[model samples]
Target: MAAALSLLLWAGAPAAAQRIVLPTGEYMDTTSLRNPGCGAPFYQYYQVKGKYPVASATLARQAQAFLQQRNGRYTGTGLITFRFGIDCEGKRLPWTKVLQTDAAYRPTHFAPALVEALYAYLQTLTDWRRASGPNREPANYLTLLSFRIQDGKVVAVTP
Candidate 1:
């Protein structure tokens, strides 16, 4: 009788396993998962709370100010997109990538300057609240920044 009860209890116990749901709607054991060639975790931004280092309105205002200060000018309307990761300390990760630009103006040299200006402005954003995950641990945040410029002036900034 003791042996039978022990066997029953053991069989009824929950398994100590973890499963993660993939983006393709497939469930996979956490242990069976492998990192892709990207050298980064699969869910890099999953646990992040506040994605942007600064508030949207503040970013927009700063972008405008930066453009005005540098006398940045453009001939036609264009868009610039930037991507980067913010670590748990609210500092930008060493990985900054300039995705692409939709420049529709002459003097193509302005594009690179615009990118640099944006980069410089971003470097000033150090007062960020660290992102936390569901487990209450600090997590890295990935974010995209978009800038719209017309006639050499920044008209909008989106986070």
Candidate 2:
């Protein structure tokens, strides 16, 4: 009876599996992903309290500031999304990809250099917080950030 009860409790425990759902369809060779030294089941930031690179508003501001200096005046009216996993050590997984789309969500391409520059800038960040498992163990977190562009200017960022 005790064993059965234990099993029941275990089954009732919180889920630790990853739950990533992205609208990404196009493939981008933007950043050469490196092997993450950490293992996962990956979880979205929302799955764990306080497990994100920075507050959403602040993240957008920072990205805007960075891109303002590197936009190169290349024009595009579309959205770019970056999707990947971040390890406990704040390292990105070796499968990061970018997807670009027009305002109507149709697949499109932005200036390759501009997209590549943004990808490189993302890699330079080191403040991502790793999500914790239900058992309080380290778990890689899935990250997705979308950038809104207009005539080569980054007008907004969403995470």
Candidate 3:
């Protein structure tokens, strides 16, 4: 009877298992769900709360600024892939680095810049799991971005 009651209470708890209690008494949990595309594009900033010291908006702005400043005066297209991980404790776990580099001779040199900017943006989100890899960096909150470049610009990006 005691075990049954305990189980019931546990099940009744919130869906977020690792709720981060903030200084303002707010709690944050990393939940996995797809972002339903509304009128605008989906960004990690809209999804996380108290998951990182920096806000998601700030990160996005930084990434955009970086790209806007760097993507100019370049041409061609390339692909960039990155991987990182997060755990139930909201801590970024160790993973592999899945960085793919294509030389300018193959396509263009703008691939790495787009990737770095995407990662800079990801540095601001919370509650994500990157696939386990051999050379991945460790963090409490993980962010992964895969960018598709076209015409010397990033045409599409995905988590």
Candidate 4:
């Protein structure tokens, strides 16, 4: 859907850096994404700490509402997991990775339209809580969101 991709472009993902490698060996060109030159994304379950409560939990709630607002589109019983990073300056990078699986836990493809819609919504979140080093330096870390769908509806969102 060109329209969907066009909307994704406005989400600020530039075509130069934003790359989408579909299983069909095709990629979407997004030409204006803000390059979050913060740094490499690192994940350490034990190392990441919050001097404050992580606000990503709030984002999870918002995503649930988003699904409800567009109820008829996302159809299927499965799980969609997204892994991404929030840069040092609290900007989300474009290296988002999505994994989908059916209710039986087998790898599968959820509706592409649904995936794109949700991905677009994630790009709109501006309330990311930046993690900082003990000395108060901006830090880059990875985060995840898993949406559970059942009977063509998003039933749960997990962090």
Candidate 5:
């Protein structure tokens, strides 16, 4: 069997940051995976709006493809990571919450590529919005994507 590794990342406060590692750099986070269910991700049901029809699995595949094309070693055996926050510019931003993965995966090196692809896809979804639960007051927010292992280890992240 192919060994795997995954990681997650938080945007600010290096002190608050954490990291997870996996072998072959292609590992899965067994937990926190949103299943490809009867409908789109819960976010889609709410403020997130778009005419372009796509599924969660397709989104995952797209992210994996983007990773592979960038020479990333992910073999698709991992849970995803996420983040929801605005930049210094205060633009509504939803992204893959990046994890420190491994020594080779550094913010200065691979972060931009991964984030760029994710943002590009997100931009395609119009009026992207999110709410914590159905029937509750909807909060205008950006959603961040992330993944984690049962033991709290990060699998893969996009920031």
Candidate 6:
């Protein structure tokens, strides 16, 4: 997956920020490409490479704002990792999973709320520009979203 990440980062650089027109004729900013996570055999099998699906900056900012609003009401610190996939049809494949959670925060009452909120925010995202292989067939891509919260504030959100 290192190769894929490298290609994505390279194509996403400011100098290479060309607009990629999808099969559906939607224009996507190359810089919006995100790091498709590793450790998934599906990615290797499909030979998926380069940029992955990502929300527009405006939508991403809105989602972050929503998360921050929800985090403001919580009282503990923790990290949450969410995994999901985007299918060839440019639809979210209902394969969401919680990859990890801090033990202290796992059993908290607000834990479910946080998870649900993130899921909801993800659902609000538009369809991604599908990844294609050498054959030009669209392939599914795995993605990871991580949230780090501290003292009831969201400290970071990583790809």
The C-alpha lDDT values of all candidates are: 0.51, 0.62, 0.39, 0.61, 0.35, 0.49
State the TM-score for model 2. 0.70
Q: Across residues 34-153, which tens digit of lDDT does each residue of candidate 4 receive?
A: 445554445442356522243445655677677677664567999877666556766665555677889998878877777776777666666667777655666777776677878666
Better lDDT candidate (1, 2)? 2
lDDT of 5 by residue, 91-152 (tens): 33332344323333332213433434444444444433333334453333345554322122
- Tens-place lDDT per residue, model 3, 20-59, is 2223221122333322221122123213321345444554
lDDT of 2 by residue, 1-159 (tens): 334222211011111211222353544322333344556476786786434556666766777677777636667888888776676666655354578888888888886777766676666666677567788887777777788877776677776
Candidate 4 Cα errors over 4 Å, as ranges: 1-11, 14-41, 50-61, 134-136
Per-candidate clash tally: 2, 0, 12, 8, 27, 0
Give me the overall lDDT of model 4: 0.61
Across residues 49-77, which tens digit of lDDT does each residue of candidate 1 receive? 55565667777778879767978664545
TM-score of each: 0.60, 0.70, 0.37, 0.67, 0.32, 0.54
Error of 3 at 26 (Å): 39
Q: lDDT of model 6 at residue 93?
A: 47
As a TM-score, model 6 comes out at: 0.54
Tell me the lDDT of candidate 3.
0.39
C-alpha RMSD for every candidate: 17.2, 11.8, 17.5, 6.6, 13.5, 14.6
Model 3 — which ten-residue stretch has the worst lDDT? 4-13
Residue pairs in candidate 4 whose N, alpha carbon or C atoms collide under 3 angstroms: 12-33, 13-33, 14-30, 14-31, 14-32, 14-33, 15-30, 15-31
**lDDT (C-alpha) at residue 84 in model 5:** 43
Reference-based lDDT, residue 131, model 4: 74
Cα lDDT tens digits, model 6, 1-159, are 335323432122221223322332211123334335422233532356423345334444666698776653654477655555665655554434454345365523234555567566666655555667556656666665666656544566664
